[model samples]
Target: MRYHINFGQNSSSFKLAVIRALTGILLMTALASCASQGAQEAELAAQEAARVAIEQEAASLAQEQERLRAAEISRQQQEQAAEQARLQAQRDRQAAEIQARADAERRQQEELQRQVRAREAAIAAVEAERQQKLDRITALEQQITSISASVGDSENNTEFLQQAISVAEELLDVLASEQEKYEDTDSQGNTLRPLAKDLIAELEARKDELIRRAGTQ
Candidate 1:
């Protein structure tokens, strides 16, 4: 018997796949159209690697889901086989934990990659701006102008971080909204703590810098 995934076109999984495809396509298009051959080659390399990684992950997910469905069917059929059910339950739990880890790590990697790409694009914009003013500006003046531009770009970045934090908070609330069960420093908490900690540190650092810059101004 064949099993089908029931996630519809409107589902988050489908949306995520569309987003990933679009992102990869956009990145590769940008890399291909890059004016500088050196940058193009470098980005092409990175794009290929990312493509390979995404494909591998897709394959793994498909296999894992199939395995999960088969195991569920077997469990349902062998409800009277207590010993077999016990072993199957243990395996199912382990498989679930492994899948969760893989999903979390992939998400973290993708988020970090997007952040890096955003920063690089921002830096490129600042560099282009600096180049435009280079002929008329002194070295120190150009540096100052670039710094100002980057600071403006950082403000946009801060907003993205704020939105991410808000989403994370919402997810935390949803996970803990159990009626009878109490969750503590469990898997979700463990996954979130590092991210929350890092976000706070980065926001604090940005705040301090902005304060210092304001004082100078």
Candidate 2:
């Protein structure tokens, strides 16, 4: 009876040990499953953060590219404007040079015309002086011819003297008529006085000689 009692007590202790071990194993399994579920949630959060960062980087890159394009377009417009201004300045300078050359040519033509007028004026003055000299020479020649005719009549024979007397009388009558035309004017006509007096003296001498010869006959 003592031995059986001791065996029974030992069996009860063993069964209690087994029950405690089973309960400890079940608690360990539940704790492991909760840890695994927490690990999966942490991994999903990290992936979502990485995706958001990538989207932000892409947006920034697109904006930078748009800014570069706008800056290039503005630079091209400035270069074209500068080229157009340079061309306009060159054309204006060329037009100014042409105008200056035309003005110089006009002045040269006016100077040439002035020189031609001066030359013509000089020639006209010379022609007028020459005409005046010709008129003075013609008057002197007529006076000399009349003086020669009067001197020749004074040296003649009796028959020639009678014929000379008649001729002298006719010439005296014509001279008296011409003298009456100048009677109202002064001796400022000094050239006509000497010629008229010489003709009158010749006619008087011829008439006296003719009367003397006729009385002797």
Considering every candidate listed, which one attains the maximal lDDT? 2
Sum up the clashes in candidate 1.
Answer: 0
Q: What is the Å distance of residue 74 in model 2 from its true position?
A: 0.5
What is candidate 1's lDDT per residue for 9-63, written digit by digit as tens? 5598878989999999999988777757878788999999999999999999999
Candidate 2 backbone clash number: 0
Candidate 2 lDDT over residue span 142-205, tens digit each? 4334434544555444454455456555555645454454434332322233334465456556
Q: Candidate 1, clashing residue pairs?
A: none
lDDT on C-alpha atoms for all candidate structures: 0.59, 0.61
In model 1, which runs have C-alpha deviations exceeding 4 angstroms?
Answer: 1-80, 136-217
Instruction: Give per-model CA RMSD.
Output: 59.4, 16.6
- Report the C-alpha displacement of residue 202, candidate 1, in angstroms: 34
